[model samples]
Target: MKFHNKKKKSSRGRAKWHALMTIIAVLMVVGTGCSVGFGQNSRKNWEKNIAQETVQVEGLEGEYTLLFLTDTHVVIKDSEVSAQEAEDQESRYPMFVNAEGVPAEEQFPEWIQYANEKKVDAVLLGGDIIDSPSEANLQWLKEQLEALDMPYLYINGNHDWTYPWEYMTDMGRERYLPLLEPFMQGNTAFQRLNLGGLVILGIDDSTNQVDAQALDRYREALMDNRPVIVMAHVPFMTQSALSKAVEAWNSPVVIGAGNFGGIYPNEESEKFISLTTAADSPVELVLAGHVHFYDRDVIEGEKNVPQVVGAAGYQGNAVLIHITGTEN
Candidate 1:
């Protein structure tokens, strides 16, 4: 009986050793994967190499001037971390700089100075407010915006959805909405900014999910005869494989597509196209920024009116648009 007990104890000891080895091996694999994944994702090259330029367009010749800029990808590294140390962390998400993460007041002093000098009636932040909603970054951006004194509006971008599953949680987005709400007269979904004679309609294009109530509000604002300006983060085109493969993509649908369905999906582009094509009101311009490069397209609408997509400010340069209202 004593001999049998010794053998069982030995067997149990071997089993424990094997289990320990297995756990160690699994941990090593996971560690390697995380190291590679974070390294690959942490290259905020887009933020560092941004180009800032002001493009002035005199289309409608209106009394009010609106500034269109997007894709700043700002980042504010932690206080204890070196800027270089935070570089990798910044690259992992969009808006590399935190709104409250960095001293935006110092980083873009010229931008603020220019806005003051230009005396812009309204500054329309196209989208991609921050690389991610780092608590510090959001607060920082809000502080800077509050100091602006001039009117400003913010919408979401693809990067705002950098959380798990590439979607910005409702609560996360809502937290920052209060800071931007003052600039906008009414709600967050969409706002009809009445800047002098111009009617700036800022639309949320960060999600593919189309809020019927928001769109209805937008339509109501557009019905007015004043010149209409639309701002969104992503282009209203379904450029994804699933959308293109099934012939689900088209111009009419893509133009009014929202950021729903995940990164240029079929539903968004189709819906976008349908809206732009069917828009009976005078939509003087549609400004979008998601593509890092600058591009311009003129679509002839009713009464031979032109719908224009201005260049993106990915390089950190704001697109300065000056509209001169032509006498009828």
Candidate 2:
């Protein structure tokens, strides 16, 4: 009986070894196949393009360095990103444009260098990570961010709303949200970062309007006594129906055409108004980058509340902002 038992034990061990080998072989094949597939689909147009100018600015209230990047406007995948290119650097974000557009990749390096020199605590990307929702590109983006020495936050823009809702499959939903899950874990509306005396918030307005719950989160974050910095991709307000109707009719009473702010409030406008009106948070500075236009508005309807716009920091058309505030 003892000899028979020893033989059975030996058979079980051999079976386990075979199973492990099978898994290893399958993984290797899959990895190799993916590599080949990626190489074949590389976009030549993007590889050659580089941004020459840099976007660098100081924070509003506290001594902080903030890097604001937006509108990559194209898909950048594993095949396009060369590890050798940034071997010495901790993180790499390849900026690109589609065919027949102005190139900015070469100028982008200057911005990175400027950030390192400024010693910014965090990097803030104001959305449109991909021209469209490409899994390979999004995954590559996640990996690139993981390499960053400092923490970074991402907001969403209109371009990212192309999730093919018509099909609405389980796989499709999974593919869409998970791509942004890395940045949307804790809060839905905005993320607040408090570094020493500097308070920074990254907000999302891609889908138009802010959720009530998300507004509450931002409100709660402001409970702490520090100057708040708001960063979002789109304007906080837009034209009302009355304003739009006036624009269509060309009424002289309507001033400044339509107000290009925050996606033309309907149901969401009330929530936004409530959030902004509630007890003034330490939000002395507001920075945004959507609409592709350059305009500065002073939001001093109330005391200690200021909002500014910074967009398109490029040659012939670029802007950088500087703000200083006291602990009043």
Clashing pairs counted in every model: 50, 16
lDDT of 2 by residue, 32-87 (tens): 65434343222132222222222222333444556666654434434443454233
- Candidate 2's C-alpha runs over 4 A off are 1-62, 77-110, 161-175, 184-188, 238-263, 277-279, 313-328
Q: What is the lDDT of residue 58 in candidate 2?
A: 34
Cα RMSD, each candidate: 16.2, 15.9
| lDDT, residue 269, candidate 2 | 43
Clashes of 2: 16
lDDT (tens digit, per residue) of candidate 1 on 52-151: 3322233455466666667766565565655643664456534333333332223444455567777877777776655655555666676767767588
TM-scores of the candidates in the order shown: 0.61, 0.58
